[model samples]
Target: MFKDTNQEDYGSTRVEKDSIGEKKIAADSYYGINSIRARENFNISRENVHPELIRSIAVIKQAAAATNYELGLLEEGKKDAILEACSEIINSNVAEELKLDAFQGGAGTSTNMLVNEIAANRALEILGHKKGDYHIIHPNDDLNKGQSTNDVYPTALRIAVLKLLVPLTESVSKLQSALQAKEKEFSSIIKLGRTQLQDAVPITLGQEFSAYAEAVNRDRWRLYKITDRLKKINLGGTAVGTGLNTSHSYIFKIAKQLRNFSGLSLSHSENMIDITQNMDIFVEVSGLLKAAAVNLNKIASDLRLLASGPAGGIGEIRLPAVQAGSSIMPGKVNPVICEMINQLSIEVICCDQAITMAARDGQLELNAFGPLIASKILKSLEMMKNGIDKFVDKCIKGIEVNQDRCQQILDNSLAVITSLVPYIGYDQASILAREVRESDKTLRELIVEKNIFSKSELEEILKIENMTSPGRKK
Candidate 1:
């Protein structure tokens, strides 16, 4: 989306060449020869490369230009033009020029070249040259100098992953905060608690929500900590992380340039070959995301159980009615939000398996599955963040408790006898519980009539405040 201020006329088709042969692409296209070949070869995955990965590659190109210019390997004009082109990619939708398929094969070489080619043509335009004038500034020579797909793609992928994680963690934090708010609001409401779909004991709704909050908080921190290893990159490791064909000064200086350009606290990996050869870092990230998804699935299942029915089921809490749940079943409402979350969580867990298989199947020099890994991980993060945000805004924030339903269930259930166990022995409490479940008399009547506890004592013991934690003033 650039205006031809230089007023150069363009033709319909232009010829471009690589090691294999020459191919004709659109004269107006910003993508170059390798992109043409890649577009033809890897058309299976129609999905465009992740936008954040494109931005990250552009960032690495800027850093490379700066470092090359400092080392006197690149001309000042070329460096400035490349920087301008990369800035355009980063700060604008000019990154849409990177149109190669995300699921490209073999360690993302096509995707890397596509970024380099896009920057080259855009820079050529900035310098008043035609689109495909590689004589002045070439994609591989100038734009991709001192880097290889091995180092550059993984480094950019890491940068992209770190960038994408910000919103996801924020979403998790919001969910945790919302649950905690519910915890405080429902602190006084006593409800039935179940284990294996059977009544277990009495628990305040606040306590249930508090447990949910704690689980989410743990997942947030789990994602936060596993990303530390990702900050170490192998930028200078050219083809196989050995720093071959690159100077020692270049190897050491690229990290600082990358940090300055990307604004991330990055460092050089102590062993570049190891980082390049093994993609365990990505596997670790995916596993943590799976943990988060598992927690969310459990929480969603709980909400659905608590909000099961208005008259026929548990009916302890009421979910927000965000949509018409049925087309023909008049006045039917369902827990669609929680159901959607359940589906999303299952998808994320499956994606983790894909990422794991990608990591596990890599060979000695480099992992050829970077493209798949990047695409899946980035999509998972985005889905999770958006799902959590919607769940909070549409479901959690608007939920209401069926207080009367909860109280009725608490009064009729045998779970309340657990609180009386410490006062009367477990054997006697069990007998009273069985009798109440079978006979028409309530627990209060059965306990008082059996002379185990008087009416006043029964009333004091079964008070809502005394049912939970001990030592409260009546």
Candidate 2:
């Protein structure tokens, strides 16, 4: 036989080679080796799992492990090991260090792998060993034990929505507050109310601001309603909807654990099969987001229109100078911030369509496109949050009413057609309105030309308060 040349010398010992002529590795050399296979296997990337969703998944895993430990489903050593691992991951130093791409397949399998590797390493550290030793807590058998991607992914999605709902509600509330303040400040001011873009009647600026506030209030309530549904989680319905391989005790234990960890008043869903197969809940939430986007878009449009121009536009409101509006036009400050918000709102509306399509694409037992749903929903949430903050700080809070301009428009307005009612009577007032429109004459000039009332009488009668107050002048 020829002398074998595949063997390698390490110090004084000869290390034997494998069939492929590769040297055998020590146990430490193969740390976290399983994650490589997981990473490669689930490589279908239509969309990336968002960071917010990842944090949500980590939270759910921590909650489940804590609950199982508390309920005695796990022994003391294993419970401590698991909790220690979860705590380390939760308070990890390497969270910011993770630079992997977010678009792994299988509804965030790469994310799952990342979480598992981090948690496993943390668990090993707690057990007085080096990281990536799968003995104390294997990523699958221990860290992700008693759970499946089906349950975990959906649970994480819901929890992410729940967490986001708080900030969203706060932002809406702040907008409402700003509107209320504007209403009070503009209470005495009157402006022409337009119907079909034509001057109709005189209305207080306060009334207009109040309407904006009320619209946001309605959107806030809509968000609250959808967020209530997010409280239901499918943590125990591992793999499929049946909870087959999981013990009944384990299901309840995990739910209870999650409740304590998240402090969200979470509970197990009643129909696990329906929850697994249907993404209707996500659609409902996205619909609410679309509703919010519509309201915000409308508000932003109104802001732009109301702040239209210093010379040619409505010029009824003035926005603070946040930045230069144009590069070529000197002293040109545009409503660019509100425009940005409007564009963001449009994108949010489109994301809602993506959510609707993803929900409808679900097949019999599994919705194979969950990763897209998670991605779209999270994007909607973050964009809405950012838009709300910018609109508030850059536009709403800095808004100043152009009092002189408002009064100029109001004085020239033919909206005073109602003022002639008490003096010229309804029929004569109607004629005067028609005549004013036909001749394009100011309401005050018409009242004076027809001598409908004495000048002093007209002055007292045409006061803005007389028009806006619910009570008629005696």
Cα deviation in Å at residue 30, candidate 2?
A: 12
Alpha-carbon shift of residue 71 in model 1 (angstroms)? 0.3
- Screening candidate 1 with a backbone cut-off below 3 angstroms (N, C-alpha, C), the clashing residue pairs are none
Q: Report per-prediction Cα RMSD to one decimal.
A: 2.9, 6.8
Tens digits of per-residue lDDT for model 2, 271-362: 88778888899899998889888888888888888899889999999988899888899999999888998898889889889889988988
Task: Report the Cα lDDT for candidate 1.
Answer: 0.88
Off by over 4 Å in 1: 2-11, 470-474
Q: For model 1, how does the per-residue alpha-carbon lDDT over 163-215 read when each residue is reduced to its tens digit?
A: 98989999999999999999999998988888999988788999999999999
The alpha-carbon deviation from the true structure for residue 229 of candidate 1, after best TM-score superposition, in angstroms, is 1.2
Worst 10 residues of 2 by lDDT: 1-10
Predicted structure 1, TM vs. truth: 0.96
Candidate 2, overall lDDT? 0.74
Can you give the TM-score per candidate against the true fold? 0.96, 0.85
What C-alpha lDDT values do all the predictions have? Answer: 0.88, 0.74
